[model samples]
Target: MEDKKKILLVDDEESITRTLKLFLDRRGGFEVRTENRGSQAVRVARDFRPDLIVLDVVMPDSDGGAIAQDLGEDPELQSIPIIFLTAIIKEQEIGGHGKAIGGGVHTYLAKPVEPDVLISHIQERLGV
Candidate 1:
């Protein structure tokens, strides 16, 4: 059997992480791990070694940008792709389109994202 794609989801909201983890695991053909505390994301990612990361932009502990920077600086983790799921910016603000921000190191999706859209984005980024 082929190895499954690995994904790490970091969100302060336990509900969000739970929902996404369940959805991705059942339907996306991927191994999913989730961390509810933003501060712990890097450590968890280091251990999980996911092929991609789904992050929340604003969290009480640490913002997604800082986490992404930390991951980027790590040679072992730098190649992983990060997609930011956020409500910090309104849907219309980015032309109502999920845009690839941060020079493709990150992609931004509005909060209340549809599961299918999120999975599609992940697949596209992972080239699956």
Candidate 2:
């Protein structure tokens, strides 16, 4: 069987992380890990080495953009794709295809996103 893709979910809300993890786990094709603290995201990512990251934009400790920048600056983690899962924008703003907010390169998905939609985006990002 083909290996499952590894995914790291970085969100400050434990509930969000847990729910998303459960959804991803049940959906199959992915090996999922969750980190509820934004400050710990980079450390966890370094250790877990996920193929992709679903990150929350707002956090009490660290900002998602800063984390993404850190990951991008790191030679070892630079290649990993990141999808910003945020509530700052409405789903309609995504306009069919996800967009890069603030002119950044990473894709952004509005909050309350459907699990199936998230899964499809993950598959698209991973080329699965």
Q: Which stretches of candidate 1 lie over 4 Å from their true place?
A: 95-104
Runs with alpha carbons beyond 4 Å of true place in candidate 2:
96-104
lDDT, model 2, position 19: 89
Q: Pick the candidate with the highest lDDT.
A: 1
Please provide TM-scores, in order, for all candidate models, with all chains considered together: 0.90, 0.90
Error (Å) of candidate 1 at residue 68 is 0.6
Global lDDT of model 2:
0.86
Candidate 2 structure quality by residue, lDDT tens digits, 1-128: 87789999999899999989998998845899999889999899999999999999899999998898888878888888888898898778865355443344677788888889889888888888
Per-residue lDDT of candidate 1, residues 1-128 (tens digit) = 98999999999999999988999999998999999899999999989899999999999999998888888888888888988889878656754345443334467788888999899989989999
Query: In model 1, where is the ten-residue run with the lowest total lDDT?
Result: 95-104
Supply the TM-score for candidate 1: 0.90
